[model samples]
Target chain A: MVTAREEILERLERARPPAAARPAAMPEPSMPIDPMATLRDRLQDAGGSLQFATRSGWTEQIQWPVEATTLRHVYSSLNAMPGRGVGLSSKTNHDLADLDVCVLAAEFVVIENAAAWQRPGCLRERAAALLATHLIVVANATEIVATMHQAYARIAPSDASFGWFLCGPSKTADIEQSLVLGAHGPRTMSLILLSD
Target chain B: MGHRERAREFVADVDRTRWHDQALWFVRSKRDQAADLVPDWEALRDQASAIKRSALTELPELWREFEEHATAAGTVVHWARDAHEHNEIVAGLLRDRSVRHVVKSKSMLTEECGLNSYLEAEGIEVIDTDLGERIVQLRGEPPSHIVMPAIHLQRAEIGELFAKEMGSAPDLDDPTELTDVARRDLRDRFLKAEAGLTGINFAIAETGGFVVVTNEGNADLGTALPGLHIASVGLEKIIPQQKDLAPFLRLLARSATGQAITTYTSHFRGPRPRSTQELHVVIVDNGRSQLLGRPAFREALGCIRCGACLNTCPVYRRSGGHSYSATIPGPIGSVLETSRDPATHAELPHACSLCGSCTDVCPVRIPLHHQLLAWRGELALSGHHPAWRRFSLNLVAWLFVRPTMYRLLGRFARGIGRRLPPTLREDLLPAWTRQRHLPTIPKSSFRELYRERQRQPKRPRPQAQPRPRHERNG
Candidate 1:
């Protein structure tokens, strides 16, 4: 008996068109003259905010709640802002549901669309980015790329089990096309650019 | 009912029809703005089209390569010949894990296969996490628009539905407050789900991975929290290389909603590292192979599901997506649905005015209006058109060949048209004049005016002036 896979493949084999040559390499769009400025504008358009600070002063620049009691459960993997760390422990994704703020390091940032490439190290860390009320990504100023083409060339699929180009906080315009920020993920996303 | 009948029903609500048309036109205008920002927009569309064309020719090789790489990366790959098999495979996976609750993001493939209802029949609880999809799912209706599923609805209608279902305040029609209600509701469902199911946007054969794009990040959150992830993909979603993603990723969001990019463009290679988690992929070939074999209609496989064609389609914008009554709506849906069942969807091809706006806005350059035109011929050949329509068309064709007969008939029709009362003339072609007024009949034919001019004397021509020597030499 032929398996489903075999049957489908056989049908495709029978119906396949003649092979055609792949087109020449896609031409790269010219890089923006000021990538950081472009990234800031694009980020703001997507309902995200961008801030700049020196490497040492970046932690102080975050707009932490005026009342410390408001942020009860903060999850930060970076050593600069200490919080409850999931680390390499076997923390289930549900354990992070009540997370207030999540701050993690981004591998790089893309300028064409203000997005940070976040490769969470553990399952809990990955879920934290979505479940938290506020999400912050820290990236160096020198690591910005101009387009998705440049971004893809920098990373490989094998680098992590899961990765994402997170632009703004999750948003929806489903209700009569009215833009609503914070649909299912963090309500606000801030990218802190460190001037190294 | 045929498209014309359904469209008539939709257009009966004049205010709603006007709103729907303007809403889509607004999105189309945004797309034009986004396209203007990119200097190389046309080049990207051409490159994306060529890459997809090349990929379709060797799908067998691409899928095999994808299966191998995915398997090697600790993801299970399954194949289904049709929608039924696809549903069964997904249900069996959930059943094996004893998963009572499953959280799903927007996967049109699943909708096409009726996966939600299939799972529900098996006593499995399924929740659509996307805000738009959940609204429609709760309302027990299919999505009217691909990008904005609940676009056909008004905020007041949603407020009422949520008031009844989610226990929100009555008459609370504000979008922000209503979205907050759904956000909190879906978040709890996301945490409790045992499995997550998503649809693939782009399946990279070389990397043995897939990418899912969403603005709300529902797919990411749903899949990240659950131990088991099952992604359903159509066979046409495969690409040959990783670099090929650049052009597609660039065009998809800009064309879909005029965004620089979606909020989340997630890439999943396999299960979570060092865990017993599972990642399963089901590749479905539901009439896609047959479509690929067709020379005239094969390029449609390149669709990235952007919905730009829908936004720009005058018929779709005015009539709304539900009028088409197909899984996917608008110009592309007409082509795909007619090819699958010509007898049933024969009216879909005639739904277009052949303005070709869809082809111009298509990110992959599918030439949608041309294919819709071709479907008309195919349907006519297959005897899908009504006998009366065929008879009338044949009569018109016969009259068109003979100039004398054509002119005589034209004169006779004009004479009758002038004598008829205005109301009677409007009622003569009720279908055409129902929503429009007939133009005033011409006083005389163009041929009569030409003959009249020939009988008159011609005016004299002006004398040529002499040119300077330097100008002449140059």
Candidate 2:
């Protein structure tokens, strides 16, 4: 006698009440740092700064310790952005359509025409890159692929350049008719394109 | 802020002109494929949700433990109940240290707090180090999309915006060239910033550490170079341990950008080598404690900001992020807004295809679609529904539930609709349909067919009874 909707409603009704009891054993932040000391240290750490190695490309080094305030400032500023970032590259020889930006997300490295975006596997990689905080487009300067049409030439029939269309974070402003930020998606962008 | 039918109208108009809806829908399909690729996607989602729920359940204790451990590790932890409190604590911490001019990575919580506005008012200049954020900052605009704030913009528009805003060339059209120009602009700010702010992706209760995922390594660089480091996190962001991190980390980047992982998933437990800037964590409640107490929407707290639903939502695709008018937009935006301020965002829940794509796409498995449906009930109970919409919904319900009334109405509609003059009842429909005509319905209702079947003889009809014996069961 139970329709699917009825079963769902019934299950929902049977759902347990929100856990009334808080965990007795709560973990606390081990040792509260002297706020002043932490800041002083942070400013000193800033003296070290970050230096990029051309060989390994964009690698992340957290440094032994990260001051909470310094990190907060970085994150806060970063949060309020969709910076001027675009990934571009030109690789004349094509085994795939469009450049793969997937590797770029973590490696900050751009790969030449490794696979066609129209291809299932290749397209997935490209899509992942577009959604990333930064993008890498690897192509020969002479071989430019910008619009969806140029993409077709590079991608195989099996590979469709769908990922390119969803290039940024997916978002909506359906609440109160105001454009609220970060409803969903990256909220920022960085693109690295190979020039030569 | 709330959803205004007017903004939605504006988006619809633009959507029709640009066909941007199809573009977003394509992203939705990509999300679906990505989800489908993992056979254990649903199970992983369940585990992630369960982990987050468990973490929230034990938040007070975990938070306490985190504070103790982080402090021991040389990090300061501060508790705040709302944006003002969180910002105040942060500002107070800075004032104590004589710190000014902070650098930052993307932190939506700070944005919600209007931290930059607050800081500017407090006579502090803040620099955003993330590339996209810097772009919007230069243009003096709020981000449009979560991932790509300026997604609504074209290269030419950006060129003009930067040119006029940043004193760059007025006609720079190449996205690459413009980006290089901004890089130089932001690099200067980064080097000079005294403090850095980064948002917490996941705050580990056990280790007293936080994770910041970034593709450009902005968080790593910004935090590394700043004199002071501040991480602002909502209370709900805490997770139990690093062991529980794998599933989320694995899912976060891939489900979000289809990557193996983000470029940087840095875990910061303490200040650098000997000392880093004052390491302070503003553990903010800012509406969260109250939200956690509300059972229906408690799961909304588990969100990791992947933005899958926004990409998948048809309505969001057409309307863009501006229409919802909240800090967060899209289907998830509707859910968050409904929970935050029902009256202001009452109309948001209606902007759904009910396709359940959002629910399916969610990495944390928030049951977004169901929550969206639940909002309508919550909104109605709260008396937030518009009178006209309520009446229409009631009228539809009445007719559908009453077969006789429905049949008669169907017949009447068919008769009148078929004979309608060239100039139709335009106002009766949404503007989307003003230019398009609806197909006329047949005079009869499906119920008529059902009645006719019942009227037929009960005795076995030879042709029907035979039913091609072999094929009958088949």
Best by lDDT: 1
Per-residue CA lDDT of model 1 for A1-196, tens digit only, reads 9998999898889888888889998666667998888888889888999988888867776665334456767788788877753423326768777888888899899999898998888777888888888888999888988888898889975677788898988899999888899999888888988986
How well is each residue in A54-166 modelled by candidate 2, as lDDT tens digits? Answer: 22222232121233222211111111111221222322111112222223222121111111121112322332332333232222223333222233334332221111222
Q: What are the candidates' interface root-mean-square deviations?
A: 1.0, 17.6
Which ranges of candidate 2 are over 4 A from the true structure?
A1-196, B1-4, B12-19, B29-39, B394-403, B418-440, B452-474
For all predicted structures, in order, the TM-scores are: 0.95, 0.67
User: Which 10 consecutive positions of candidate 2 chain B have the poorest summed lDDT?
Assistant: B427-436
CAPRI rating of model 1: high
Model 2, residue B447: what's the lDDT?
78
Q: Give the CA lDDT, 0 to 100, for residue B12 in model 1.
A: 78
What lDDT score belongs to each candidate, Candidate 1 first? 0.88, 0.57
| Cα error of candidate 2 at position A22, Å | 15
